[model samples]
Structures are given as C-alpha cells and as structure tokens.
Target chain A: MIMGNLGFLLYGNLVLIVILYLYLYKIRKIIGFQLGMNISMLVGGFGAIATGVLLIYQFPLKFVIVTMITAVIGMLIGAIFGALFDYQTLLTGYINGLMMGMMAPMVGAAANNSVLFLLFIEVVFLFSLVLVFLSAKNT
Target chain B: MNISQFLFVLFCLNGVIGLLFYVVMYKKRKLFTDRFGMVMAMVGSGILSFNLAMMLFFMFPFNLGTLAIISTMVGGGIGILYGALTRFQSLLAGFSQGSLGAIMGTMFGAVVENPALCGLPAAYFIDVEQHMMLFSLFGTGLVISTFGLLFYSLRV
Candidate 1:
C-alpha cells in the first residue's frame, strides 16, 4: 500500500533535507558564500536524497558506485582536508556522512552479512578518529 | 541468530573489547586508561561500529530494517550541519553529536524510524530477530561523542 519502509526512508530523507537547508541559512554568512549553495548542507542534503532516490528508483545501477564514491570524497576527505586548511570546516561529519551513504554499496559487494560489514567500518572510523586526533595534536 | 542478531552481538562485543582495550591496554598508560581518552576511544569505535551496522544493512537489505540504518546515518550526517553551523560550538561539539546521535539512535530502535534520517542506516542497527537495539544506540552514542572528543583533543 504505502510501500512501508520506502515510505519511511523517503520521509526521513525529507526531514534531513530540511535540516540541511536550515543550516545553509544559519551559516550562509560563513562558508556558504564561498563554497556556493550547492556544496553547503542544504543543497547537499537535497543532492544526496535526489541521487539516493535515483539509486533506488531508476536503478541506473552503475552510477550507484560513482555516487557512492563521490559522496565519500565530498563529505569525508574533502570535508576534513578542507577543515585542516579552512578555519571553518565540516569535514568530520562529511566523512562520516559519506560512510553512511556508501558503506552499503561498498561492502554490499563483498559479504552477505550486515553485521560483519558494520564491524569492519567501525574499526576504520575509530582508527581514523584516533589518527586525526594524533596528527592534529602532533602538528 | 539472524543478521540483526549478529550485529547486536558485534556491537556489544566491540564495545566491551574497546573498553577493555582502554583498561587492559592502557592500564599503564595515561591516555588509554584516562577517563577522557577512554571515552574518546570508545566513542571513536562506536561511530564506526554503527556505520558498520549501517553497512551491514546495505548488504543484507532486510526489508524495513535496512532502511532504518539509512535513517540513522543520514540523521547523523544532517546533525553535522549543526556542528558545522555552530563551528563546532565548543569542546563539547563531538560529545554533543554523540548525545544527539543516541537520541536519533532511538528512532532506529523504533520501527517507523526511517533509515535515511536516523543519521545513518537501519541495517547498521536492525535486530529484527532478537529485537536488540541497545547495542546499536550505544554504538551511535559513542560515535558522536567520540567525534566531539577527538575534535577537541585536536591540536588545532
């Protein structure tokens, strides 16, 4: 009927879109002006939802990998690298967000078990966090 | 058990081991065994752990459960907007995210929870069989908090 889980997933994305947009307004003075509206959270939220939906509905399939990788680069590496350089940085969350967006597809190819995939990523997250902390302090 | 059950076990085991690593591994060290350091390490591992759970869902795609993991990750991502907007507020930014993530984590604990919005994925925390969500929540909670602590501990 309502598509149960799909309905809920779509709804959640919508809410995230709103939060991200509101952030755009909140930080428009700071980072948005420089990065443009699209790179900012509001637009990124829409982008992720739109692209994610496409991944779900159209099933172009191939783009799933590209989109997944791009999201990772954008929200994680770019965000963090951007932070280390820029005083105003959203890299940490970006990295984590990318992980959220891509983990499924990345590990989906390998193991059939969700639990194993989660454990693998957690190790990376914690290790990275530690590295970043150590590096930042030493620097 | 099922995939979700496996995930539940994974979270608890990881959390226990992480803490143990803090205690046993750092019993002689100041950083590892220290309250703050231990918290940060635990939280760091927790964030990934939940992400791990989310990844699990992407692989398994267990009906509503998979979507739930998405919600958690997305929610966590969106919350980043908060941290970013506040410019990370204070030393508590990472910790705040962890706390907020836990709150959002509960939504994953609940069904209509929306995988895309809980800040991550439902597969990450879905325990359809044994019905265990505590481990999932704890993992997410530690994640946000760890990020905050890690950020604070940063030299920058």
Candidate 2:
C-alpha cells in the first residue's frame, strides 16, 4: 500500500515538473537573469529533494545509485533552466543543484518512517511552484 | 601505505592546495569585482568544504556528530577566507554555501561508511572501502580542475 503511494507521488512529481518545464519554456524569453537564477535554483533543488526522497523510500537498498541519479537530475534541471539566461546564472544554478542533490538522499534516509514529513515537503514544493508562477506572471 | 593512511595524505594535500589557491587569489584579489568575488567565494568554499568533509569522514568514521561539527566549522572558515576578498554580502553567501556543503558531505560520508544507517542491508560491506577510495580520488580531481577553472576566469 505504501509502495503504491510512493510510486504515485513520484510519477505525480515528474508530471508536474514536465508541465512546469513547458510553462517555463513558453516564457523563457521574458525571464531576466535574476529571476532566471531563482527559478533554476528553486526547480533544481526541490526537484532533487522530491526525487531523492521518493526514490529512497521506494528502493531503500540502492542508496548509492539513487544518490547519483538524483544529483544528475538536479544538475540537468538547473542547467536547462539557467541556460535561458546568463552564463553566471547557469553556473550558480548548477552548483546549487549539485549541492542540494548531494544532500537530499540523506534527508530522505533520515526521515524514512515519516509519511507526514514527506507530505509536508510536497505541499511546500507545490506552494513554491505556485509562488514562482505568480511571480513570473507579474514580471 | 594503507587505505586510511592514503586518505589522510590526500586530505593533507587537499588542504595545502586549497591554501595555495587562497594565497594566489589573495595576490590577485584586487582584480576581481564584487560579483566575481562572490561567485569565487561561493564556488571555491563550497567545493573545498565538501571535499574536506568527505575525506575527513572517510579517514575517521567514528563519532559522526563530532565529525559533522568539525567539517561544518572548517567549511565556514574556508568560506570566510574566500569571501573576505569581497564585501559583506559575499561573505554571507560564502558562509552559507560552505556550511551547506559541509553538512551534505558529512551526510554522504556517513551513509557511505555504513549503509545500515540508511536502512540499506549490510550486504555491500565489501564495496564500502572501494567506494571511499573512488570518491576521495574523484573529489581530489574535481578540486584541482575547479581551482584551475577559477584561475582561468581571471584571464578572461
């Protein structure tokens, strides 16, 4: 039962990320470097955290592989988002993503038994996404 | 000689290299603007702290709480040193990034040392030592390449 919920959460996150990516792509031209940096960092860090936590929960045995995968995911997301703006933004996003990715799995591991914490994290991520969307729209 | 000894030597080498980079950057600090200095502090401190924490953890796997604290302090120190080249804002950025990196590195080291801590089975015991060696070497290479890139940025 729990495994099923985890899988659902994981897929849901992926879908949300894809949708966000599409939205960002549509407005990529309008984003300034400062906003671009924030967007990249936000997406990269939260995406990595969600991915790491969910994957670790689902597959507790494959710790190392999960860490590597999440780090790569974070790096890619940050780079893609940051690429829309300046090189410095890209560098900032990349480093931030890498650092967050490196940290995420351990957080997941430490909070393994707490479904409530996971839910809270997901809610926070969604709220941030909404905030970003609103901010982007205003700009 | 042994794996632990090798790790210790590598740790010392990394410290020396980090200090040498600091000296070189100090010599040329006046050439950097605020923004560039901020980026330099953030990147340099983050990478150095992460590498240092990971290696230190590998060398001494016992007493994780103490190690984590030590690594974090070391990272903060490095960040302050790097950020001192610039202004207050960069100092703040460097310190935060350094502390974050240190915490992450320490967690990574703890997990690598004992998979069981993360609820992974102990079946991978044989691979733990190998992973440590591989990661430490990779970290060293990363430090060297990153410092080189930072130096090259000055010319451009």
Candidate 3:
C-alpha cells in the first residue's frame, strides 16, 4: 500500500489544518473583519481536516491535494463576503466549499491537461486574492 | 456532460452569483439575511422533492427505489400532519422521527426486494448481481433525502 510521496499525508493532514487556520487568521486580519469571518474560517478549517483524514486513509493523494486547495480558496472567498456582509460568512463559505469541492474535480478532469489544470487553479487563486485585497483596501 | 457534472456546474454558478448579489444588495437593503433560513429551507425542500420524484419514477431497475420513495412520502406526510396539529416542539420531534423512519425503511428495502410487487417493466429489471449495488445507491439517496428534510424542517 506504498503510495509514494503520499506517506507525508498521514500526518501532514494535521499540519495542513494548522497551516490553513493560520492562513484564515491572516486573511481575516487583512480584510479588517471579525465574528462572521472567524466562524467561516473555522468551518472551512474543519472541513479541510475532515477531507484530509478521509483522503489519507481511503482516497488518493491527488484528491487530497485538490480538496484542500479548493476548501482554502472557498474560505478566502467567504472572508470577502464576510467583510461586506456581517453575519452570513459561515454559510457563504459552506456553500462555496460545497460547490467548489463538487465542481473542481470535474473542471480539472474535463480540461484534461495538467498544465491547463494548474493554470485554472492559479487563476482562481489569483482572482480570490485580488478580491480579498480589494475588500481589505476598502475596509 | 453527465447530469451530475451539469448540476455541479449550475450549482457553482449559482453560488458565485448569489454571493455577489448578496454583497451588492446588502449595501442597499439587508432584507435577504432576515429570511436566509427560510430561503435555505425552500431550496433544500425543492432539491429533495426533485430527487425523490426522480428516484421514484426512474429507479425501476430495482425495487429499492420504490420502497425509499414510499418511506419518504409516508414519513413526510405524517410529519406535516403532526406538525400542523401539535406544538412547534412536537412538530420538530415528529419531523425528526419521520426522517429517521425514511432512513430505516430504505435500509430494510435494500435487503429485501419484492420485484413481483414492484411493478417494473421486464426491460428495466436489474440483474440479480447488480441488485445489491443499486440498492446501496438507493439507500444512500434515501439517507441524503432524510437528512435534507431534517435540516429544512429545523430551519422552519
């Protein structure tokens, strides 16, 4: 059952959760937000942890990576909404995570090229980051 | 694209648009958040209704689909009736019980199939070997529908 390079995933998932939480905190501060954003980050963090645990044991490394990335991006988008809307951030993140988790794999598979997939992921990341920065500046 | 992929795409677009709309509208009017729970309930119920209806009519390869639908309908009807007659707490309790019943009934259905009584066309009948697999899928749908109802009811 040696699935090369995935060996780190067994324990790396725990570390990943910690890193994700820190990132959430940093992004929340940058956006000058509180309460709702915190809750959203917590939800997203827990979701990533759950996915990580499941992937480590039952699924492939690729799924683990994709899900973790998608969940983090979802939280960032949620934070942007949290800045604009005071109380709906947690629910927003949940919805985003649900949609992203379900759709990202399909988009990746449909594109059918590693380069294209990476390009798409990077673009989404950049877009979310830009939104976050704009919201932060407005605040 | 497959139905699921199509649905996922639609869901993603909805999420993005909904988020943007909420942000834009919040500046002008905060009405949306006030009814968020109800809105979520409506969406959840609508999706469950569609899924349950689909399962009932299309899942003719095995008898489990019919059983799941029956269980869900019976449970939901009893829940709504009890809710209408009793206190809110009683309504909630009854709804939860009904959802649980739907799940338990679906499990039972998966294990036992009365194909003779199922009334499916011969062409749609599942092979003996695939029965268990399809039953599991039907059972999963039942579980999702049950939880979804429970969530929607609680929101109400």
Candidate 4:
C-alpha cells in the first residue's frame, strides 16, 4: 500500500512519450525548439521531483538537496542545448553518436596498449571515413 | 538499500541530471538552431559507448582488473549502435528495450548464482544487490550523458 502510490508512474510514462516525440520530430526538424526543449525539461524535472521526495523520505535533507541541485543542473543543460541549436535534426544526432562511439575504445586502448591501440584506431578511423564518404551521398 | 529500489531511484535521478547537463551544455540563442556538428558527434559517441559496454562485457575475460573495461566497452558499443540506428524514435525504442535487456541479463546471471550472491557477502567481497543496482543505474547515466555531452560540446 505504501509503495503503490509511487508505483503508478503513469504520468511519468506519459511525459517520457512526449519527449520521445519532440526528440524524434519537433526538435529534429526544429519546428518549435523551445517547446521541444521544455518538454525534455519536463521529463527530467519531473523525475527530479519524484526522486527528491523519495530521497527526503529515505535519506536526509542533505541528500535531497544534492539531488535537487543535480536535477536543476541537468535541466539547465537541456535548455542550453535547445536554445543554442534549435534547428538540428535527429539524423545528424545519430551520425555524431556513431563517430564518438567508435572512437572511445581506441582512446581506452591507447591508454593501455599504445602501439596496437593506435593501429586499431587508425584502421577504424579509416573505415569510418569511408562510411562517411558513402553516407555523404545519401541525400 | 534494496537493489530494485536503488535502480528505480537512480534512473529517476539520471533523468534529472541529463536535463540539467543538456541545458548547460547547449544553452544559447542558437541552441538547436543548426545541426552544426553535434548530430555527428552524438551518433559517433553514442555508438561508441554502447558498443564499448557490450563488447567488453560479452567478449572480455572475467577478471578483477578488467570488469570496468567491460562496462566501458559495452557503453561504447551502445553508443555506436545508437549512432547507426534511428534517432529520437529509435533511441527511445532501443533505450527502454536495451535497459530492460541489461536488467534481464543481470537478473539471470544473479539467479544462477543466487546462493552465492545472497550468501557470500564476505566470500565475494561485495554487496551484490546494492552494489549492482547503484552501479547499473549510474553506469547507464554515465554512458548516456557521456555521449550526449561529448556531441553537444563538439558541436557547440
């Protein structure tokens, strides 16, 4: 009975759906960047609200305060991203994600296995360049 | 704290942290105004982290010095997959499913070793549930935010 109240996270689900939409459509196309960003903020901010409550009940005021601060910071970051580049598209986001994903391993390897790591990175980068070349002709 | 409870709470915290991080990273008049280079960065880094996590976890040998290596590996792999797949719509689809997938795998593994996990606090030298729940949540956030921030920073 006690936990059931928080169990009904229907509203949270609803909000997550909305952000998914904006992230996929509105912000992707930059239709109304501010609106989309606001939606994103709602998703994150609401979670913060819920968790802040949980933290206070479960832990202490200090932990709650820290969580609140972190939540605010995350919201601010989303807003900043929206305000700065409201016209970006999801396709582009995807591509950027791809590049970064491919590189980190090399970075990691370099820290441990410099020679082999650099060689692997070079190969991956070379292949990636080719992919970029091919994708460039997509549209 | 309970593992399940910790996971739920941590994810909730991640949601908040992501929002704030996004705001600070991309806050500007021209924010999202142009695709700039972030789109590319996101794709690259996203795939990198996700894949990194998966690869390290699935492929690497189980050892004390290399467990973190797996997490990071899986994270990169996931990132690369994100980059290659559908965006926004695809991301949510993948994220929710992938997260559940991760949880399921972890559950099964633990179940197989239930006796050990539940019993060997001293033998294993770790609080299985509490540790995993906290780490998984934090790791998810860390990987996602890592990609998100890397792309945003690169572009803007």
Candidate 4: docking tier: incorrect
What tens-digit string does per-residue lDDT give for candidate 3 at A1-139? Answer: 2334334543544454345445545655545335445445444433433333334233322432444355455445444444343434544444334334423433343333334444344444445444544454456
Top model number, lDDT: 2
lDDT of 1 by residue, B1-156 (tens): 555565666655555543543344234333322233323432343355344444344334466445555545543543342223222332244445444444433333342234243233345345444333433443445445445445554443
> Root-mean-square deviation of each candidate, in angstroms?
15.1, 3.0, 14.8, 18.7
| DockQ metric, candidate 2 | 0.38
> What is residue B124's positional error in candidate 4, in angstroms?
18
Look at candidate 1 and tell me the lDDT of residue B109: 36
lDDT of model 3, residue B107: 41
DockQ scores for all predicted structures = 0.05, 0.38, 0.01, 0.09
Output the lDDT of residue A43, model 4: 32
Task: Give candidate 4 regions above 4 Å deviation.
Answer: A12-139, B1-35, B67-156
User: What are the clash counts of all predictions, listed in order?
Assistant: 45, 0, 0, 83
**Candidate 3 C-alpha lDDT tens digits along B61-156:** 546556666757755654544333324543454465445545544543332243333222243245533443343344334335334433433333
**Least accurate stretch of 10 residues (summed lDDT) in model 3 chain A?**
A52-61
- Highest-scoring model, TM-score: 2
DockQ of 1: 0.05
Encode model 2's per-residue lDDT on A1-139: one tens digit a residue: 5556898888888888888878888988888877888898898888888888888888877777787788778878777777777666666776777777777877887786588878888898898788878888889
Prediction 4 global C-alpha lDDT: 0.38
Candidate chain B TM-scores, in order: 0.33, 0.95, 0.31, 0.34
Residues A1-139 of candidate 4 have per-residue lDDT tens digits of 4334433442443354344444444334433444443333333333333333333333322321333243444344334334433434333332222222222222232233234433443344345334432332331
TM-score of 3: 0.36
Name the lDDT value of residue B9 in candidate 4.
Answer: 59
